[model samples]
Target chain A: MAGSGSDDDAFVFPVRTHFHAMARRPGGIPREQAIEAAESHLHELHHEFKEWLDQELAEIAKILPQSADEVTSDDPWVEAAHARCQAVRDTAATMGFYLVTFAANNLCEAFDTIRSGIEYPLDAIDRDFKTLLLARQEADSADRTRLQELIRRMENPSAALPPAARRTPSK
Target chain B: MTRENLNLHGINFLVADANAYFCMISQSILRSFGATKIYEARNAMDVRRALVEQRIDFLLCDSMLPPSGGLELTRTIRWSANSEYRTIPILILTSDTRLNTIAMARDSGANMVVAKPVSVSGLYNRIAWVAFHPRSFVDSPTYFGPDRRFKIEGFPTGVGRRKGDKEFSVGEEDGPALAQDDIDSLLNLARKA
Candidate 1:
């Protein structure tokens, strides 16, 4: 459990100022309870967002092509996939899942550019989705750091990956 | 006021969020802050029904409600002929912090926009700011909401009254009116969502 006094001050968040201010008000909520509640919400979001991501990825599998040249931006299935991708971005951002949020954002931006008649690598989106799922399972800082490095390597494939981190893209 | 001193005896709150966990957590935070009679709405229709059926004082809404979402709901509450809560304080809580999203929130008549995963103090301060020390409401041809200006005399260089352009204030009665196209551009951004 994250103690209110320790966890609140440890994180450098701008909103904590607001929380402290409200906590001082004559009839405001306590800082400890608020932190606890927020932590609980984050736990639930992790589970729920994981389920949502799986469903979205399943849907994307049915529509997305193995190559970039086969689809247009206006296709109904593509549009639907974009919507789900956006939902993932928004929800992950809300939960403070920074890696998933970052990957989803880039994927959306790539799609937007592709829709505007720009030719780009479609494999990047799949790689980003895979990275999002990998980041989801990372529960520690070292694991997260390694995953971040893998994302970087995936982006710049010229960079070599360690033997333990190398893998084939399943989709 | 301290935690024990905080007194929300008669204040009624409505929290509109599609996420059940978020709703529950927000309610818990409010209750800890001494608030009672907090209502939850999961969708836009439930929000409308809650407004019509209850005497709601403050509204905390998520930006991504189903159907049309919260920005459209803000427009409806602000401009609807049948709404009695046009002047009620609305605070948008969401994780979408795109520049266009913030602009739409301002243009749609929201009192404040707080990013999600907010701290208790952050939520409380915004609610207190809205409830007690609100900015003057503005009803322009293309916009209707609390004044977007947070600073009175802190415009960046060359932007406002620099080089002695003119000394003036943007009160409820006097300000530069936004063009229709500018407003349309923002609404268009919301549509892209």
Candidate 2:
């Protein structure tokens, strides 16, 4: 609704309250009460994130090729997969799922690189998606350490990546 | 030791989140904190309508609303000609972790920028901090809303200052803080025509 105006609507929404006559809230919320209130909301979001991740993973699986060499930037499948990766990146970042967000970001970048005719190793793309899935599963299981490791791997996958996964897909 | 419970007995809140789940979460949390009236808006348009119809005490807005999103919303409210709407505290909630994104939130006149999935403790902490330590809003030619700069530990020379640089700590010259009377009158002024 933000851009709904004609670019010159000086006044859109207006309210006339006796602001000077109204009493402000008593004071700042106590720390304990604040935490208790926040926990309830965050708990719901945590479960919601888990459910969203599951759905995203299922969607990702349907689009992934059996082999990295099958990737084609112009292919509709590639575009769909890239779009999914972007959505995952945005949503996962919101939930503070570090590994998933990072991997998804790289996955988008890899797709972009491929689209630009760069020969980024297709195996790297495959591994990135695999890493993202692993992170999602680990997050579901509350494996915080593994999530951190996946984040590290996403930051520098080539260092710990197996030799086979470092190979480029044949054009 | 003294303990005080957070009491939102009569507070009215407007939550603007594009996601239905997020709206539910924010509303639930606000209720827990003792808010008596909580309004939900799924997009920028609804947000405007809610503002027009309700006497909101606080606002929790998502940065990814639709069409224009929270950034634009913040600008609209902050620059509104109406004093009652302009001074209402706004919290920009989003998942954007990029520094530039946070900077954009600050530039948009948000009272605070909070990252999601926001936890109970994090949300409360920000609310309490903002409530008790409200920053002086500045309406400059190029900027509006709460002052963006805050002091950081060990940054003695101030932001971007070298160790030998002679600039005093930023904000030291603001003098004694504005009195309640001064603040009230200052906030009542319109920044734009």
Candidate 3:
């Protein structure tokens, strides 16, 4: 919803038709139909969330290089990066995508830790920045696995899947 | 109980919400206890990490924060040895009154939850009560309503009329319902109920 125009509009339409149509149907689309609808909407939401994550991570990766080298430029773009990262986090949480959420959350913490290390001492910020960059890289790598797991979750919300380390303690 | 021995030295507390108003409200609630040391984090991770690395006593955590919610932070603090920053009492401050949010907050390791439009007395009652009995819910012993702060703890709690200034009847425990003849008073209390 932050960016402009009709793309956001598309997220609402087809699912909405199914929603309204289901609402008016005889006795609300039977048990099987209800399950079908739930699965349908969840899949849509999952895909939508993944698309958003992919776009944001790509944008962040692009920004890292641009901002990393320019010493005079915002000397600290960490806060802004965090602000953008926070937006990604909130969306993941609201969507109940905890794996992605967990990674994003930890990544943000690392960014803050490095940013806070900015003191009169010269190399602290740079050292922190390097640590933060590693964290970002690790998160980018983890996103693929999380995205696949999330897609699987959409297919069967109740599936008792094998416990992956990434899923547990996703708090 | 009373604002007695709660003053600790000049501890600086920081709050870092992108929302200035929410941060201001949190600052005011923390300041009420005369605790000069308070800090705010823009989100959970920053605050949690700083709490471990610094010296902070009471933490007021927001349940719905960006990146990760406060629960994740609480877990990290409680479980990780590197973050054993004492069993610092944490009171989760949230505007969300939803059952799921409350459950989520507790899941995150909050000792208690405070609903928002945060009130000073509510904040005080919650903080003191939690600090007094950390990890256990304290049943509020007195009824808080419009006219007075009275009790139903035993021996005809309210006096025969308003016996001048006050009198203490220190026996038994009585329920909220008394004579309906005091229906106005009863209704007043009932309205709150």
Candidate 4:
């Protein structure tokens, strides 16, 4: 079920395949099998990550939304969404989709903490779920701008990143 | 928004900066603009490491690559490096706009030079225009814009009137546009992305 569920995620976030295709372009990829190179690698990513995300999605779909208007505070689906996004983010980072990986990491830090925390009582699970949904929605709303910035940087190295948000990896 | 690494293999964009919010927003926008992969590299050394490690299609370089000036770095890449790595198009953004400095920048091998501080909208269009329409663009010319000491108008042949239409066509003297390939690179880089 999880395997099939990630297909939905694969459909929405297709970074893995995009990266694979680029890597295989030139100065990369094996000498042999260059013939079917593009197709095979891209397809492989779609199958692996997307399928896993699809499964995660299926879990969310199953758990959340008791009825169109009846998603209660205790909805288990919200937790699933948070977890799925966490895993997806980790996977996206490995594949080289900067924005997706960053976003996924964002989701993990935001939702996963609350999900795992003992601070939120069992009775108030609804509040936690609401917070998760709200945060996710905010990120979703900003997706267009975020991704556009990502594209600009992709096209040219000299494009500026907002100075306030820039980070340096440690030595 | 936070992005995650996926299992699939493909292109990744790397943002080389130390500011966190700046990285987040820029990385996010880059994707919306059409990049599938994005990475972050802060400072000059990070940029070098990223270039060596990843198959970066694009880079978001800070004009202020601490310790060393970004302008100087562009010059090194242009003059010293071999073609394979040198092929990457670098867009240099500088805060100061001294005419002489801009001229030196052109010679340094920067594909395009943008004045800073750039508005987000301007940044978006500039990167998209250059990255998406690469073939149409070429090298940025050694333009020495207006300054008291050195200016395009100060040229021996009153080139002030040579701006806009007066310069390119001159009443149907149909030769190659501008007679300089570098200017074409600027026009193309600044063209609609």
For residues B1-193, what per-residue lDDT tens digits would candidate 2 score against the true structure?
2343445666678888866656776776777666668899989999888888887878899887776989998998888756567867789987665676777787788878888657655676566555544565665445557765553232211222356755434545655444433533454342221
Better of 3 and 4 by lDDT: 3
In the predicted model 2, the residue pairs found to clash are A38-B120, A39-B120
Against the true structure, whose lDDT is highest? Answer: 2
Q: Give the per-residue lDDT digits (tens) of candidate 4, residues A71-156.
A: 33354555566645554453444333445555455444545445544233333333433433443343345555676675466455
Docking class of 4: incorrect
Per prediction, the TM-score for chain B is 0.75, 0.76, 0.59, 0.58
What lDDT would candidate 2 get against the real structure? 0.67
Model 3, chain A: how large is the TM-score? 0.41
Q: Which ten residues in a row have the lowest lDDT in candidate 3 chain B?
A: B137-146
Candidate 3: lDDT of B62?
64
**Tens digits of per-residue lDDT for model 3 on B78-121?**
44544444244566766456676765565444556776435444
> Best by TM-score, which number?
1
- lDDT tens digits, residue span A1-171, model 2: 121221231112222223212223346455565556556555567877778778877988888776656455666677677756766776666456777777778788888777766666667877888878777777766567777776776577686878877867689
TM-score of the candidate numbered 1? 0.62
Ranking by TM-score: 1, 2, 4, 3
Flag the better candidate by TM-score, 1 or 2. Answer: 1
Give per-residue lDDT, candidate 4, residue A86.
Answer: 50
Q: Which has the better TM-score: candidate 1, or candidate 4?
A: 1
Query: Which ten residues in a row are the worst by lDDT in model 1 chain B?
Result: B152-161
Top candidate when judged by DockQ against the true structure: 2
For model 3, the interface Cα RMSD in angstroms equals 27.6
